[model samples]
Target: MEFSSNIKKLVMLVNVTNSPTESEAAEDAHQAMLNISIPQTLKYSGVRTQSGTDIECSANETILCDLGNPFKSDQKASLIIIFETSGITLFTEQITSQLQLSTISEQTDLLPVPVTLNVKNTVLTMFSLEKQVMDTSFSGSVIGESAMNSTRDVGSPLEFVFRVQVLGEPLGDLGRLVIDFEWPFAVSNGKWLLYLTEIVIRGQSESHCVPPGKIVNYLNLTLSKEGTKRNKREVESVYPHAEASVTVLTTRKVPQFLDCWRQTALCQSFSCPLSNMSTQVEVRVRARLWNSTLLEDYAKALRVEVKGKATLRLLTDKPAIKMENHTREFTVNVDPVLGEEKPYEVPLWIIIVAAVAGILLLGIISLILWKCGFFRRASRREMYEAKSQKAEIKIQPSETERLTEEF
Candidate 1:
């Protein structure tokens, strides 16, 4: 319906020829209100007399009236009066008020509250309608929240509705063209006054963790518009608990992957005191996502020179001291950290093989000497040299004796 507010104020007068006879056709208009309920709260008694208009409807929409008489019609009614005002119209508005969680059944989710209204109507003379030609349109947030008793709660969705009557009380017929209706509702806790908007429950799922090592942080959740329409797309664009958050968990400080000991931790345990290790080393471990620029530079070998601190020890509540991923340049002169066991190591078989080979080599050498005639070559050479020397001495002596006889 094409609805207008100020234009309906018939201010100008028009000239007419004669008064027309009034027809007895009892033309009637029925108006209904859309609702917004707060969980854990009851509608206030002060809401019934509030005023409002069809701000969302079209021109054909007859002005909303508290079930009362056809109060008034201005010059614009010429068009509105003729049409068969039909089709359902939905009304919605937010009510603000204090909430009562005590009376509401304790629930993990939100609850809804109920409200009621009694529109009145009666045939009256033109004078009878002047007082309130139409109920005035009050802006949303008109209703207020009030205290509620949370003591009693039965199992239910807290699903209830409301209208223009005294909430939580009996409604009676009005003196005009309106019907009286009552709404029953339940309510829950919210940050605002009765949460004029539907409660948006956004949360992550439940999770568990084991003892020792690694961060257990991540969740899957769903958001629902409970009671009435509410969401993040347009409803709560600026709300917190949005994407700007990330969770962190730690059973024990993660040893750095770079250090000599921690590097072996994934496959086997190593002797590294976890107590003295940098608590911040986990940052370095997880910072792969951050891609530290200096590390990236070194990784790219972009420049031979870059100043950076590779590792920092983080003392934790644990008894051991150790850290990892320290730059090769950063050496911790810590006491030789020992685990309950020093890496159960195996002896290198090569050493054993070399010792066995040395024993076999010495035996081989002794055998060779025994078989090749130890001193045989030396004895033969001595015999041959002695015979040659004896022959030489006799020849020389005989030559000297012969020369002396001749003289």
Candidate 2:
């Protein structure tokens, strides 16, 4: 079975004509006709959509639009409009618009109509948005140093002021900023206790829209000496009871890192002493940019890392003394004990004693020799007299023989 019915079509028409008459009634009629067409002209003015240039339509996206009217006239009207869509669901959605219509009056014949009307749309979603890190940089320096004792001791306390500057721009909603400072195990040669005494941070930003609310003003960091094997072994050999201590004003356990935001400068004073005779200390600083709610679960996709180093010398405080060279010239004085010529005089008693001892020794030796017949000698005068007597007797005998021969 087929059913057919005649649908009634409704059509209406009105004549629009204008004529110039020298009468007030004709002018009033012309104004009334213009007013009647204002609503129809506004209805066909069209809807203009305004949004971000980089907009990519996704779930729960906010879109802004403006409604423009093309007519220039003084007329008042109220609009109640509804939007209908198909094949999509909205969660916690709201649409708002602001409209102002001009009033039509006899005194004011023509008025400018507002061309644009502003509207806002909010769309809610269940998924979170991803953040982006724009730029990052870090720098650090050693500001000053303080020694607790006048004479450096093995476990004496030394303080150093370290300043670190962190700069970054987070394109998405900022989550957290972390700054890490790593001191080398050889900083104190494991002989001294090293720890942070105080930490102060100040934050600044190029964009005024971002405040310094998420900054962490203070952080206490305690580094482990166990990380350094060589220095710890040497320290244990010298001081068996030596152990690293936390020097921070608070007794809380030291944090390994610090969290903050934007362009920031952190100044920290560390208390470390020359536990042994270490002359230099070295420290490393690392900064990370994180976009996450918690510090440990930092977003690796939008993270930045920067590193720096600082070295402190213990002997920088001592003053150096230089020795001046000098030359000396000597001149001998001739008028005194150094130059006066005097003969070396022997003692009279000593000379006499020496001479008498020599004479006694000579006499004793002579008397002993004479007693032993060592000086006996023959008589030359007696031998000569006996020879002369023998010669005279021989002469007498020869004279007697000569006399007898003559007789």
User: What TM-score would you give candidate 2 relative to the actual structure?
Assistant: 0.15
Model 2: pairs clashing at backbone N, Cα or C within 3 Å: 154-275, 191-275
User: What value does the lDDT take at residue 256 in candidate 1?
Assistant: 22
TM-score, each model? 0.16, 0.15
Across residues 203-222, which tens digit of lDDT does each residue of candidate 2 receive? Answer: 23111111133222112123
Off by over 4 Å in 2: 1-230, 241-407
List residue ranges in candidate 1 displaced over 4 A. 1-344, 348-352, 367-392, 395-407
Cα error of candidate 1 at position 223, Å: 43
**How far off is model 1, as Cα RMSD?**
31.4
